[model samples]
Target: MQTDEEIGKVAAAVPVIISRALELFLESLLKKACQVTQSRNAKTMTTSHLKQCIELEQQFDFLKDLVASVPDMQGDGEDNHVDGDKGPRRGRKPGSSGRKNGGTGSKGKDKKLSGTDSEQEDESEDTDTDGEEETPQLPPQASHPPAHFQSTPRPLSSRCRG
Candidate 1:
């Protein structure tokens, strides 16, 4: 708009037009979401419901990516599970414990794991009376983590925004 000199003055009613369009869109979405919730016998609408609503309607095709990225605010059940976990539902296939960075990120193969229940179970001489290997004691806060352990992620922040 700054460079386009031929374009006439921006109309004052443009804002109102945009507002009306957005309002109609949101109103239709909420209405359809409510219907979907009712069909699913749910008391409250959820992200899954909204996503399904968007997927069902051809007009909402553009918003599929947007809703797909949105995390479900209310985790009701199988429909609202976190991303990648589609749940062992009727149609969807069971999911696997996904490897970090697609099985290439972990340096576990190079690093020797000790007293860990890893796949390479070499019969070491460190067995107890019960024929079970003794678990290694966790390192203190000042020291490094166990050799078997990977990167230590920080704890999650509190939900309350004080």
Candidate 2:
């Protein structure tokens, strides 16, 4: 029977071992591929090379057998028994992990536009205090209106504003 510390060490190394094993397997599978492609002056891996490595039925069979044997997030060969990681669930309240909002931009009342400012803007435009006559903008051409205007007709109230 392995000691608790030995089991813990092996469990910690499982992910690294799996990743390295996959890397080596892929490198070995691609060993002759570069030479073949280089001789042909091909820019990418050939179709035959891809087909030789990726047998879909065999891959599915292997995965099915693996899942049937293990059938969990934890893989075979060792019982890791990892604890439930205590991070916040998705969309939960932000935790007290050195994060602070500083109480800014959350209140909606601070964003309301004041009535007097809008009234003053309207008064200024109506007066046109620069002494230039407010030229009546000509009715836009039916076929060639401004680039930004849509083809929809404007309301009478919108077009005839004094």
Candidate 3:
């Protein structure tokens, strides 16, 4: 039901909106990083300060990889230095299928269950039967009397009685 021009406009606007949001987020994060740097008595905001801030704050944990380390000026003859202008390479490394447990999928669930004590209890419970795993029953809820029902009733006022 959408025209090509309308669809194109939306697609173009998406990147702009995302970039603006990212810019605002980065600005605020950098301000916090500056404050952290000042607290450390450092005149210049270093990558270590930013890294420390990111690690300390749970919200900024995702930006850990984004703040790359500054290259060692001593020149130890090692190429450990990452360029500041170009950020770290994104995406998964080679031979990674973007799956946990080596792409075995749901089999990982069984592997995890095999090591758990609850799974052992489940296996023990099934031993008495035909080896079929029964659904674990949740603990019975403790019934508490309602506050209003338990409390003494208040006496009615003379005005209400009249």
Candidate 4:
């Protein structure tokens, strides 16, 4: 507790347990970080090395948010960060369908539309909307009823059968 704050009491054993847990965590973290440093052939451990250690092991997954702020030399960006050093998950390509935009991620090449598509483009351009610009009308969105709205019957247990 601070000077003016109320003191909060803790059990003596709690500090010993917390101290042991912290000691083990730091030992593992430093060992992994040191491995990363050796991999880079660097004598000193850097923040990037520590971040790599966190990203390498699933046990360290919880520390991702903290290590994400550390910068790397390569501008690999956040794309590779999601799946960690294992690369893309489920053996999918980096720019594959795992992406949100129907696999047409920013890396996807622009598709060339042809035939009736080109004609429709010209028709839209030729439209004369007097002096006002035409506003595209969007289709109404679909709404889903809450799951709790429907009730399911459950079989009675032998002890509570009526």
Candidate 5:
């Protein structure tokens, strides 16, 4: 069993790992985005291009820690780590339920409202306290990922955990 502080440390480290991984991931994505944007001068890379970049980046980042975590076996030649290639770990596919919104159904789809759904009803109400027009509250952290696809994971920490 782990103490709270120890668990907290591991939890904290997860984001750092994610952050470092995301930094590289975004770098590659931006490079591709720039490449596409420059080639066509379009407003942005098409959804397919962005999606490909994201998936590849996610794989790369995932592999970085994964490869490091494997134990070395002096007697086994398989223990050697090579650059750019490794056996695939069983990963949850992108958009799997575990990664889905914390019970907020898919974005933009109309959800059925029960009469008792008072909280849900109030959420849709438009509130404008300031004189400025209410910009649609962009889905919390939605724009952080390329244009509306909600599959992006939050950054985990960088430190090592048992």
Candidate 6:
């Protein structure tokens, strides 16, 4: 049997450790979700982006049921409210089709590649040097500690012989 103080310390440390782990998991998940959104030429992340990330990645499949399906919000003059339910609205009915806002099958006619895509295209073009020797690119340098972080070596002064 452990003392009360020992049990209390363990209990407190467990929550802190769990919270830190949760924070890290959420951070990585969101980062991947953001990448998925940007890949599809979206400025703002939507449920579809998150869904795509969850669906495509096997590691995130467990969260599929937890990610609520959100209604499409791109139509003109259509309000998102659903009979006074101030919560996330459900997506379109299982069978409706046509050029409607938020429909999975419909793509926006005005959709265009975002800046990142164009930049990536430009980079690819630059890399194609038509038979020239390609130089190996170096990985980005890791960040180093500041000069102030370095400890100076101390010299021992001559003192009375011990």
Global fold similarity of model 1 (TM-score): 0.40
- Flag clash pairs in model 6: none
Choose 1 or 2, whichever is better by lDDT: 1
Report the C-alpha lDDT of model 1 over 1-162, residue by residue, as the tens digit: 435899767788877898999999999999998988877655556777898889899989999989888664344343434566544233212343123233321232433443354522432222222422234433322223446766667656644457
Per-residue CA lDDT of model 5 for 1-162, tens digit only, reads 146564534555777798898899778767975664454433334443344344446544544443444332223223222335453233444554222334342343244422336644554542312323233333433223345556656555633444
TM-score of each: 0.40, 0.25, 0.34, 0.40, 0.25, 0.37
Candidate 3 stretches with Cα past 4 Å from truth are: 1-10, 65-162
Q: Whole-model Cα lDDT per candidate?
A: 0.58, 0.41, 0.53, 0.57, 0.44, 0.53
Query: After superposition on all CA atoms, what RMSD does each candidate show versus the true structure?
Result: 19.4, 27.1, 21.3, 20.2, 24.6, 21.1
Pairwise lDDT winner, candidates 4 and 6: 4
For candidate 5, which ten residues in a row score worst on lDDT? 72-81
User: What ranges in model 2 sit over 4 Å off?
Assistant: 1-10, 52-162
The stretch of ten residues in a row with the least summed lDDT in candidate 2 is 103-112
Clashes of each: 0, 0, 0, 0, 11, 0
Roughly what TM-score does model 3 have, to 2 decimal places?
0.34
Q: After superposition on all CA atoms, how large is the RMSD of candidate 6?
A: 21.1
Deviation from native of the Cα of residue 100 in model 4, angstroms = 59
Model 5 regions lying over 4 Å from their true place: 1-12, 51-162
Candidate of highest lDDT: 1
Worst 10 residues of 6 by lDDT: 102-111
Give lDDT tens digits, candidate 6, residues 1-162. 136665644555777898999999888788998887666545456676676677778888799887657543343333333334454334334454322233222122212332356644643453344433334443212212225566675555534346
Q: By lDDT, is 1 or 4 better?
A: 1
